[model samples]
Target chain A: MSEEKRTDLESLGEFGTIDLLTKNFLITRESTAFGIGDDAAVLERNEEQYTLVSTDMLVEGVHFNLMYVPFKHLGYKSVAVNVSDIAAMNGTPEQITVSIAVSNRFPLEALEELYDGIRLACQHYKVDLVGGDTTSSRSGLVISVTAIGVVDKSKVVYRSGAGTNDLLVVSGDLGAAYVGLQVLEREKSVFQANPDIQPDLDGKDYIIQRQLKPEARMDVIAYLKELEVVPTSMIDVSDGLASEILHLCKSSKKGAMVYNAKLPIDSLTSTTALDFNLDPVTCVLNGGEDYELLFTVSQNDFDKIKGNPHMTIIGYMTDASDGIYLVDKNESLIPLSAQGWDHFQQ
Target chain B: MSEEKRTDLESLGEFGTIDLLTKNFLITRESTAFGIGDDAAVLERNEEQYTLVSTDMLVEGVHFNLMYVPFKHLGYKSVAVNVSDIAAMNGTPEQITVSIAVSNRFPLEALEELYDGIRLACQHYKVDLVGGDTTSSRSGLVISVTAIGVVDKSKVVYRSGAGTNDLLVVSGDLGAAYVGLQVLEREKSVFQANPDIQPDLDGKDYIIQRQLKPEARMDVIAYLKELEVVPTSMIDVSDGLASEILHLCKSSKKGAMVYNAKLPIDSLTSTTALDFNLDPVTCVLNGGEDYELLFTVSQNDFDKIKGNPHMTIIGYMTDASDGIYLVDKNESLIPLSAQGWDHFQQ
Candidate 1:
């Protein structure tokens, strides 16, 4: 074979390929007031409102293992994860295009179970299941979903909007999803070794469910509106809490001082981390796929939302010179790094 | 596996899965004015326009063979084919999200050449290259692209809007893409058996190019406006001429007649089909991925377009009782069937 005949996808890497593909794009339609360059692609729907569009692709074996991943939970979590992206933009999801590429190895019943969870998510989140393509795959299943949502123009948030002193807050708990993954992996190994052994998952249900069926915090978005609190910046918890925090910080050209003690982690998540011989604090810092909403609000609105039960202020934004750091329980500062999963590495 | 677990995707079919998945989807958000059943998903954007969202998945082996298909042509065709879908709704594409899962057999330089073609398309189409996911695939390469486009409130066309007596027109010529496929396959066989034999493709460039790098008929869409003609209904020629005609017929609740003599076939396409000993008519009717626009215009504008190049008025709409029929050169009546490539069958 000629040496010139072979090419690798990784030389482009994640960032380079995106830059190459999008460099020629010019926004033409008036309706497309904005395209790309953000957490979600923004569109003008009305004089007062904007539509946000985001898409994600999840492939089996690469993204999930069917050995421990139920088809129903997989479906529900896929929808929820995409919905969380829209939520990070402070947009209410309206419609979703859920396209799945399946191999013939999957049974009709398996697909039905997957769709059942999809339908359940549509009902819970109030997003319509719009149009999608179903095709055969030569390998494991591939699910790609494009979610569309509308938001009042002024209320839309971007990760780049964080400012000095803006209180960084995340809704619900963290690290549970990552801990749950460890639990599932352990159980899968045990089951493989001895098929007769049932999964010893009694106290780990909360963390496991969080990983399997995480919910998008659309309710928190609505609540912020009722309290009349507009976030200065926002992002969703997907690639672990630390990586998401770093994204917001880097995009905003600022730094963050996250309080490790204030991290909202479920008791079960903490327990399971210890039971699995993992550090609970590390789980809270880098455990991923929580699908929770992370945002920053002005200190003035703090009085109003501080009374609310769902909000947890985990950190504060800092000037770029301050650098992003975690305030450990010992009061020592540690610079953050993104240990998030990179599919390219797989 | 048990018999119950052996039900394949083909057994469920396209409509079956769609019916099952969308059964319980209740429209929750007001912004989701419409969902599921439409040809293109309707997303309300500006006060005067709507954004059309659609997605398609192309997998290696299932969609194309790397041996016969060049990466550059594959990239261009991918974007063009997607843009054609937006054009089908009388909308201009504004943005796209390209998600690809590739195996390691491909190198970084090969991906660069592929993106080089994608960038060229983005320049030609004037659409932004937006956010997308890149991951490793276990087998072959999988590309899922979601295209977004916009239309004027009054100008946007749908599959359901064709009226009785509407004239059916198809842009450019047909059968060439399929004939081109045959030529490429034959050449592939030649090369496989005798490594030293040069491919005899001197006069078959047009057919091969048509097969490899088919252009989406955005020109027809632009010309229609200049001619003061608005198609009452339209669809792109992705799933063959016959399947598209059937879509218009089914959506309009009307039958149709297509005169085979009126079917346009380029000279090179005809020559290539003869070389392959394939029926020209069969190629035109059943060939997929033409990416040409097939639309229905009002009868009042037929005379204005009669002399124009790049289009052929192949058929006319009639009452449902009339049924869909095609007249052959020998004056034989043949019932039309959507023998377009069924992905399920593959």
Candidate 2:
């Protein structure tokens, strides 16, 4: 037999594989304003409006485990994460289509509960549930959602628009979701070891909620619009602060410096990290699924966002040669590395 | 323990479940022109055009078996099916987002080959590959594609617009894909029983291609536009001719009469059906995944479609009281029953 070259997928990773595959795309439609390199694709739907489109997939064992996660929350999260992509574009999500593949092990009532969560999320986000396909599966359940949103042509923001010296801002705190995951893992282990043990989740409500029912920060986007501030570049913090910041930097051809002292970490998140014997700062930087907005604004708009309670200016963009780094509380500079989740990695 | 109420999904079936779940959707957006009832959802993008969106999911082992299906063909089929939905709406497909969940057992080259087919489909359809998510799965593979299309507000056709006496027309022949699937399944069994036996597949190219790489009828759509004939109602024939006609009838509150002699069946499909001891007429009526266009044109436009080599006028719409029926060569009327695919049914 002739030896054919076979490369493992783990070596290329998710981001690398996507970049490789999409580099050959030829845009053929005049309405396609932007394609394949952002949180969402932008299409020129009219003279005044640009539409944003994005999709996300959640697999049973890869993205969630039903043993600890309720089906309703899984349904809500599938919608929320896709809505987050629209929020990252500074656009208001208007419609979504959800497709699912389920095994027969799930009953009709289980799906009803899941759709209840989806209905609640649609109501909360004010997005219409437009169309989708449902089919049976051989393995576990899979859910894929595609969201569409619209923004005025002038208000659309992209990750590539950030310029050097722009101020970096973030909405809400980070790391709580990761801490909550750790807590859930611990409880699962305890239950597996002894069925009599009840989960000790009394004081961990904040972190646990962060993990299970994360919200897309549409309120922050509305607040920014109310304050008359349009960010130069924006992205949702789904893959941790460090990875998202790097994404903005790579696309904008700039670097960033995040001060350690300014990184927002909730008290519950910090306490949970300590309990897990993990560094709280590491958790804040690399913990994922926060669903916050990480954005860069022109230095001129600093005053508008400076004192906003929902937002904090964490850092500033720098020349590309300077590289991405974290300035510690002791005024020491350390280079940042992406420790975000990569599902392709073993 | 007190007994809790539960319903089986199989009892409701796929269509019944979707209707039950989506019945309560409150469409708050003025831009939402159509939701959840047609081939694709329609949204008013501007004053001049309506945007169409649709999604479909294919699960491994459930939708296609890898033993007989090539990865590239699978990817091509996945994109083609979604594109067909836009064509069903009489819209020009503009862009698509393809989300995939794959197990790591697949090498990087497998995905590269799959993307090659996806890229080719995009080129052939003149649609842009916009954006999507890629992640790992515990299951074999799951592909979900969302296609976006556009049509002039005045020209968009819906499933609910058919009237009594409209002429029923279909593009190309039926039952070829199902015959192709049977060929592949037979070849698979032969190969499984003997290691050294080379299965014969010569002269079966048409049927095999129909199964592995079905094309969406965008050409027919374009041709109809050139003829200045807009179908009163349209739906792509994915779930067999009988089922699609039933969907149109149910949606339009009408009935239809199909003639057995007028039903277009390819020679290879008929011969293969005979070889498999299956009725050729049943194959044409109940076999799915043809990806042909089934539409209704006004009686006044009957002269426009009479002699088109690419189309066949097989039937006509009738009042709801007449019921859907098939007329045999002997002029005997038989009630048409939908025996099309139901993935949820065992």
Candidate 3:
């Protein structure tokens, strides 16, 4: 018999793996307006509206560490992240189905605490917890959430819609969540060495909350709607700024030039990065899990959001020939690469 | 500080755990027609139709044993089970989002095999492969599928809609899948004891296929629709006949009396059960994973499906005060209990 070919999963990476697995699937449903290769799947709902569906999975040890993370926060973050996908499409989330697989080692109260956070997110987002499956696992906890949202057909944004010269904007700040995760990991190490030693999490509430209980940018979506500024293209910043920029550029068949000086990094995040011997700019570029919206708007609509404090105009889209680059503070153009978190590599 | 009390998850079981966790959640979305406590959640799609969404999670070790299960069959089974939920609601599945988490120990080829099965199932069910998340896990492979379906508002069925004196009907033969699992388990034990010994699966093809690749009874739904028979209440036979009957009774506020002699058990399944020193009737009552449609029809519509070959009239619904029981072959009445598979207790 001929030897079967074997390839490591690390070689394909996450995106490559997904593409390889799903490339052969043909979309045959008329209701499916868009299938795969986007923030969420778009389904035709009505003449004026579209339904959006997105799914996310978080595996224990790979996605979160329970040593420093509370169950409630984990639950809240799981829902928030899936909601962020809907927000990326500029849609209003209506319902979510959360499926969790947990080992018997976890007590009933632990799951209850998790659901308490889920309930809070449902209340905050005004989304219904429609249905889900709860099953037992042999190892760690696994949470998979699917969010369904709706948007006007004319207003829905996709990553492949960016036009050349369109302004690239991002909501809120960046790098806080990643920096906060570092602090938690450090504390975990200290507590592991000496169980009696208390974690010194004083004055790090902002960063810690950014990591544990990050909110989806539904507020930004609402603000955009109020301003009547529909983005040409959009994606959520779950896998670092550089990675998201690359995704938008690749999907839109365009290039981008983002200014390092224009990147939004909270002062606390900057100082925390420096304290950990890391550069704030690097963290803002490559650190992930911010759950902020990164999008592009036409130059004509720039005047509406020009001085908006909630959003930052980081750069503009360029011709595809011009490779994606970051204009550093020193006036040097640095090629951007996605050093986003790859759980497989870890 | 006083020690916090911990409750074992085994005490709640699967259904109890979900109920306890979701009891406090209030539905706030205007689009939510019905939330939880059904085969699928119902959402308002349009004036004429209702959208249905259901999710299921399969964890390795708990849901399937890789030693005996082919990755392709596992993938196919996962999608089929989720589609079964849609069928249970008397809906047509249109789209599905499949999220998977796998350890690096699995090769890229393994995932391809898995997705091939997913693709095949998508083609079979005519469900579009939409969006999903792919991530890494610390241990075994996990597959989570969310199926999106649509049904006419007037034809939609729910577990809580059955009326007293409604005819209880079931599609396909019961306990075959469970018996197939036993045969596979026996072969696995034999293989483990002596590596050189080949599996004695010569004449067990039908039963083995039932266990590995059970199909959702969408055909039955189509037939019912063609016959103008709308079920009053419906549920997929996933957790055995007794458990499903109990769910229907609890949801509909009714009771049932199932006849053991009337259960549609195939000859092969019966012979296999006898070989394993098991009662075929007992397996039919408590053995799960049949993926058959168990539904109730009004007495007026019984004539339409009276001589149908695909369906069997197992029993009928009764008043809530009548209690649920099983009439054995000896004509003795016995109260039925849910001995369906419990992963937590295992």
Candidate 4:
């Protein structure tokens, strides 16, 4: 008798698994300008424009908990995350197709609430909800969204386009969304212990909102354009900051140096991390789901964006030989590591 | 407290549920040529072409039983179904994005096998796999696919274009895939009852293949183009012939008369359906998942496709006042009802 071999999915991680599976898929269409290995796939649209396609799936329990997360927020977050992917490519989102599968446990009203949130997001982003699929699942709810966007041929950015000495910039403060999730989880635990007790989420509105209704940084994209400073490379911070930096460095075959003092962390997030007995800097570096734009611009273009309040310069790219590192508070060059969320590992 | 209102999803059904949820979403993008209520959404691409986007979600147990379905076939069918939507719009599929959520129960080898089938389908359809999302689920496997296609501006077809005197047509045979599923289900029950049973799937290859690996009718689109015949209205037969016929009637504001004797049922399907003591006509009318093309053409163009081996002319369009009906073998008119598979109702 012959024995069969089996490999665990946890060992490969998400990116590794996708690489192993899609590595052999040959690109046979002239319309496919780019395939995989990016925030969104690029396709040739016309002489002056390129189309961007991005998709994401959010499974209940795996991505969110219905106990504390409302149906409307889930729907809105799903669209926001996918739109962020388009923004990561330096494109303007124009349309979205959302497909959802839910069990009978959710009534028609529940789904209606979900659609309301989706409609709100569409209106806020000015993207049309063009199409979708609705069907039944055996258990839990799964929402998948695909966003279509467009960019000028000359303005589109990619992770592989970062240049040596480019300044790394990020929009909005970091670690708030991660801290928001922690508060939600804690409140959930307290409620599970006693159903009669109300969740005490006072004075944490900013962080909570960051987690519940994080907006895609379309405004930052507009600001960069107004400043006449196009990013050489860009990515969305769905994963932790450290993990995204590693991705940029690997894709462009460059190294990076970030200063711990320059890391952006909200005061509420810092205080909350301390209350939870965790380091705020670690949360900013490793906590995810921020949806903020992490990008790099040429050193020469720094003058245009240096005083911009919406964005901050966190680091600079270096030669590959320098290796990726963070200058800690004590002036020590600590090698950066990625501890981003991996659902399979969890 | 006021009594909370709750509506069951089963009562609304799939189409009704989609309409209710999306009725309030207004299209805001100039690029959005058409949105929702069709096999695929259309967007303005350029001077010569219009882009098409179609999406579908398949869930385990509700959509397919893993006990009987191979992983590779499921992967292939997922892509095929989305491509079928593009074909229904008379478009050429150019790229596809496939997102899958699976639990830890599935090993890396299982996913690799699934991707192997996806790659094969991409090759066969001549479409590029541009991008997708991969995530972990709490239970079961869910696959969502989005296909992008393009059609010449002059050749684009829509469901609302049928004329009162148009001829109704269908590609390939019907009822085979439904009967094939029945055979597999029976075999599965027998296997569950007794492990040592050498199942009898003999002489059932045609029907079984139809159910397991149904191909999108892209060939029909090619043939129509070659014959210089453009369908006035079209839809993919994913939800049974009767249901699709009703969709054409409702969308085009016309009535249809289908002749039962003209339904293209393969000999194998007829015999197998009879063996199960089921009416073959009923299966043809209500059993879904055929992945065939159902279309209407102007009577003036009938000569172009009158004797095509791959297509069958089953009926003709009538005035909306005449109502939709089917002429049975007895030459008696009977109102057509949609008993097509509805997962929510099931």
Total backbone collisions, model 3: 0
Lowest lDDT 10-residue stretch of candidate 2 chain B: B1-10
A162-248 per-residue lDDT for model 3 (tens digits): 999999999999999999999999999999999999999898999999999999999999899999999999999998999999999
lDDT of 2: 0.92
For model 3, the stretches where C-alpha displacement exceeds 4 angstroms are A1-3, B1-3
Candidate 1: which stretches are off by over 4 Å? A1-34, B1-6, B196-198
- Kindly state the number of residue pairs that clash in model 4: 0
Candidate 4 TM-score, true structure as reference: 0.99
Worst 10-residue lDDT window, candidate 2 chain A: A1-10
Could you give candidate 3's per-residue lDDT for residues B103-163 as a string of tens digits?
9989999888899889889999999999998899999999999999999999999999999
The true-versus-predicted C-alpha distance at residue B327 of model 4, in Å, is 0.3
Per-model TM-score of chain A alone?
A: 0.94, 0.98, 0.98, 0.99
Q: Best by DockQ, which number?
A: 3
Local error of candidate 4 at A26, Å? Answer: 0.9
Q: Where's the lowest-lDDT run of ten residues in candidate 1 chain B?
A: B1-10
RMSD of each: 2.3, 1.4, 1.2, 1.2
lDDT of 2 by residue, A1-346 (tens): 1129677778888898788877888998999999988999999888989999999999988888887888789889989999999999999999999998988878878887788889989999999999998889988999999999999999999999898999999999999998999999899999999989999999999999999999999999999999999999999999888999999999999999999999989998998899899998898788889999999999999888888889999999999999999999889999998878888984
Error of 4 at A17 (Å): 0.9
Native contacts, share recovered per candidate: 0.62, 0.81, 0.89, 0.83
What TM value does chain B of candidate 4 have? 0.99
